[model samples]
Target: MPTLKTLQPGDEPLLEAFLWQHADTSMFLRSNCRAAGLLDEGARFQGTYVAAYINEAIVAVAAHFWNGMVIVQAPVHLAEVVQAAVTQSGRAIAGISGPAAQVEATKSVLGLSNRPTQLDESEILFSLTLADLQIPPALGAKQVQCRFPHSDELELLCEWCAAYNIEALGQKETSSLQPACRQIIEARQATSVHWVLVAENTLVSYSAFNAALPDIVQIGGVWTPPALRGKGYAKCVVAGSLLEARSHGVKRAILFTSDDKQAAQAVYRGIGFVPTGEKYGLVLFEG
Candidate 1:
């Protein structure tokens, strides 16, 4: 019989041990942060971390949080355990993010036919399996330049990210993200690298690639200035970042984008990133 228990800070090492055993080489974000973030007071988040054990040995773990959505992450074999955990939560809706097959399996087990509202379209996760994704030498004439962000680049990156949030969310700019962006910059973890792209000395776009695991890097926050849209700057920046990540010994580069964004999806495909499958994000509303 498998027993489930709540997670605590002391379980960080054990959690990492479990994740490393099953995660692909490309993921880098430490599981501890995921576990802790769900409980952080400043974020005003509430959640649960469950460790599934068979006798004295741990077989699986799941991190579920409550904040309008119950997000779950667990190993594939432990789907039954996750199902049991959700049944205990008594929440109407839940979200799960992981490998495409595992997510689908969980959905089937739950009988959750309700389509996802926010990230309804499959959050297509793409990856570059080859290391030789180099920029064509002939394209050098296009005047595309990439560089690591300088200390002075934060403000500009922040502004560009704010604009990205508004455009992506289809909402007016708000001050909420300012502090969160700052925290990400200040933390400066080894697994995270923030880059900015410049065209003729004007900041046009930015991208961030974070190590999700020892060998896996996840590309995120690819944003281009509104006025610069349709100029192909987004592709250039993404390609540059993907190349850089490959150079850093990343075996695979993964990224998630909404399926509805056909244009963005096209850009990624053009750069050699083929979709693996759907990544789900389930939302559980507050009662």
Candidate 2:
């Protein structure tokens, strides 16, 4: 039987090494640890980490974050580790995310499989090495400028975020998502993680690195307004933002999108992203 326990302060090196083996599916867990460590410090990125071990080596890891979300990267002994994650943390799970099969197993163990949620999805994971990134013709030709959003653009960015939450995720309650959208835009305002594509002095699209590490980034919150859809601006902003990230030493990028979104998937493929043969789950409860 595997031993399951909560992670401690000094377990960083081993935990990180184990997580790196599952990097694409472990972004939330690894990024949160990098930002806030194992202790649930009552901060944005802090969480109570749990690990399952076999013969003293970690075989799986999970965390129940301060925001009431659970993310796991359990490759073995799924039910035991997931159940321990919830029982040890004693936190109400507002949602859960991770590898598709793991998330389902987690919800099953936690009795959340039947719970109603605003969004529940299993999306195909895609990734690219920045060196293979293909710049959109319009971006390379300077037909559109890619730049970070201005501090004054918070409200606009938030609005676009809300739209993204609705259209992409199938979440209906915009009001419930507004505060989070605003907070993210405000918090990341001074960072290069968020990028906007402007044409003729007007914003046409938005793309952001929702999760970041020294060498890898996960793209999310991509939105081109309804009026701007079907014009290839989506690919432009993504490729342009990635080019900038590459210039600054980021070596790779990953993202997950619904399988029904064939057009969007094709756009990403056109810019050198290929399916990583992994699936990620996302579930957000309605408040």
Candidate 3:
């Protein structure tokens, strides 16, 4: 049995190298490590990182983040190792996200199966290589311009983000999301941007690179107003964002969406994204 051990400073590189092998599933873990390192500094993205190793090689990695998200990328059998790490850290875990099977196993080990959760879902993972990207006629003909949200559009974006939370994350309150939406709009990510699609001077679609590294990006927060959807705007915003990331040397993009949303899936496929045959878990607990 591989014993779980809390990681210290300087262990990041080893963990990173291991995670890179499973980049599609480890994007969140990798991005968080780069942003917060091994220690919990009580800052956004900081978390307690742990590992199970064999002969100086990291076999699996898990983290319980400050925001109460426990993200892991490990073999299903190693779920116990992940739960042990979370327990040792004594960090509150309001949610668990990871590979689908692994999360199910971890949830069982952590005895959270019966706990009421605000969100417990497994989303299909999609991957796209930027070289194969297809730019839609909407963008190619300039019918809609896909660009980063402007500072002056904060209120509009905030409303969109709130609606997105309600729809995507099962968040029930719109009034409570303003503070978080403000942080997102005001954030200046050196490696990321939230993109918006505009046609006739109206913002019609929105998306963002939630986790980004130089080589890869994970697309998230894709939202279009109900009245504005079904017009291929979602594809434009995502594809346009990927184009910008590709310009800066990002080679690939990934996203997770529910299986029931055929339209959303088709929109992604239309832009050249293919299912990666993997599942992503996004289980969130109510506060």
**TM agreement with the true structure for every prediction:** 0.70, 0.95, 0.95
As for candidate 3, its clashing pairs are none
Instruction: Write the residue-wise lDDT of candidate 1 on 1-287 in tens digits.
Output: 66776666676666667666655321422433452443423242344556677655556755444532333446534565666556655545545555455556666666764654333334777767746454633225658776677778777776666666556644344566677556665544323576666788877777786444445667777887767877777777877776676677767767778867888887777777887754634232112
Tell me the RMSD of model 1 versus the true structure. Answer: 5.1
Worst 10 residues of 1 by lDDT: 278-287
Over 4 Å off in model 3, which ranges?
188-192
TM-score of 1: 0.70
Winner of 1 and 3 under lDDT: 3
lDDT of each: 0.59, 0.88, 0.85
- Which regions in candidate 2 have their CA more than 4 angstroms from the true location? none
- Scored against the true structure, residue 123 in model 1 reaches a CA lDDT of 70
- Give a tens-digit lDDT track for model 3, residues 193-274: 7888999999999988778888999999899999987899999999999989999999999999898889999999999999
Off by over 4 Å in 1: 8-48, 55-59, 64-71, 75-121, 132-142, 169-172, 188-192, 282-287
Could you say which candidate leads in lDDT? Answer: 2
How far does residue 175 in candidate 3 sit from its true spot (Å)? Answer: 4.6
> What ranking emerges by lDDT with the best candidate at the front?
2, 3, 1
